[model samples]
Target: MLYIVSALKPEAQAFVDHYKLKKSKLNNFTIFSNYNIRLIISGMGVENARLATQTLINNFDITDDDTYLNTGICGASRSYTIGELIECGGVNYNGIDHIFQENRPIISCVSEEVATPSYELADMESYGFYDAVIHNPAIKQFHIIKVVSDHFEPQKVGKEETKSLLFNVIDDINKIINF
Candidate 1:
């Protein structure tokens, strides 16, 4: 089984609607389904994202063979154009670098340690998820897929605007995930 997480309903809905997914409420959590996929809409930010992902892992009793994907929009360095989908070559947690771009979709790096040399852009829970899941040998692989949503301005991206940004980048996302 593929385990997928999106930070908001809209992001989850993008795949849900596209696939004509059905909604189910298990316990108190919401679940959406595709033929071979199970999606959880873990609310925005890192704490919520972490909790939601953990919940999915616990509820489904996920094993090592499953793939965990944290999919959503993120801030990009100025070098990345808005609306581009990037399979994270690495993650810069605060400032500590962890490179994961072994053989996936590649992104040009600005420096040896920096994955993308943008200013501090925040996505709630990817680092924790990466750190937690990658240790499991049963898991074949895990990576983050992010789309450029905002440059540096908060006002530049509100909720509605983010969904719009996500919609525009969905095709690129498709290629990124399946690539």
Candidate 2:
């Protein structure tokens, strides 16, 4: 069982549709699941991620072998091109940095949107997702996968573009997690 988290609907659109996921509501959160995987959209923020993750774990029978993979589009520096997939090694939230065991060195900063040079990647939810899942007893291995979708200008990306970006790299994401 793999429990995944995404901050936006478009980010999880590919997997939800591809797997023919069924939707369920738990404490005001939307949970979409198939037999092998479950994905919860935490909206786009640190607090949302924290609350949604905690609620999911409290409501479900998550196991040690089940992994929580955070997949979404992230803001990238000019050094990285659009559509590039990266595994965030650490996340900086509220001036504090939280490092992870993932080998990918791309550091992420959590905010609504921000400049690229301050961090290699920027998103609104990774830190919150990491913070909550790291404390779960059933969780030992967690992953954060980001696709570079913006270069300091996330407003330029629209709904259609957001879905397209994730769709284009869904195959790679599946391969990375062996889904």
Evaluated against the true structure, the overall lDDT of model 2 is: 0.81
List candidate 1 stretches off by more than 4 Å: 26-28, 61-65, 103-121
Prediction 2 TM-score vs. true: 0.91
Worst 10 residues of 2 by lDDT: 101-110
Write the residue-wise lDDT of candidate 2 on 1-179 in tens digits.
88888888888887787778898887788889988888898988889998888887887787767778888888887889999888778887777777775466545656557754577678888888888988876787688888888897877888778888888887888787776
Error of 2 at 23 (Å): 2.0
Each candidate's number of clashing pairs is 3, 0
Candidates' C-alpha lDDT:
0.65, 0.81
lDDT of 2 at 5: 87
Predicted candidate 1 versus true structure: per-residue lDDT over 1-179, tens digit per residue = 66777877766777776668789875556889766678788765555666666777667766655678888776656777787777776665656677777654332212222244445444555665665566555666566887777664545676766677777766776565562
Q: Which stretches of candidate 2 lie over 4 Å from their true place?
A: 115-117
Clashing pairs in 2: none
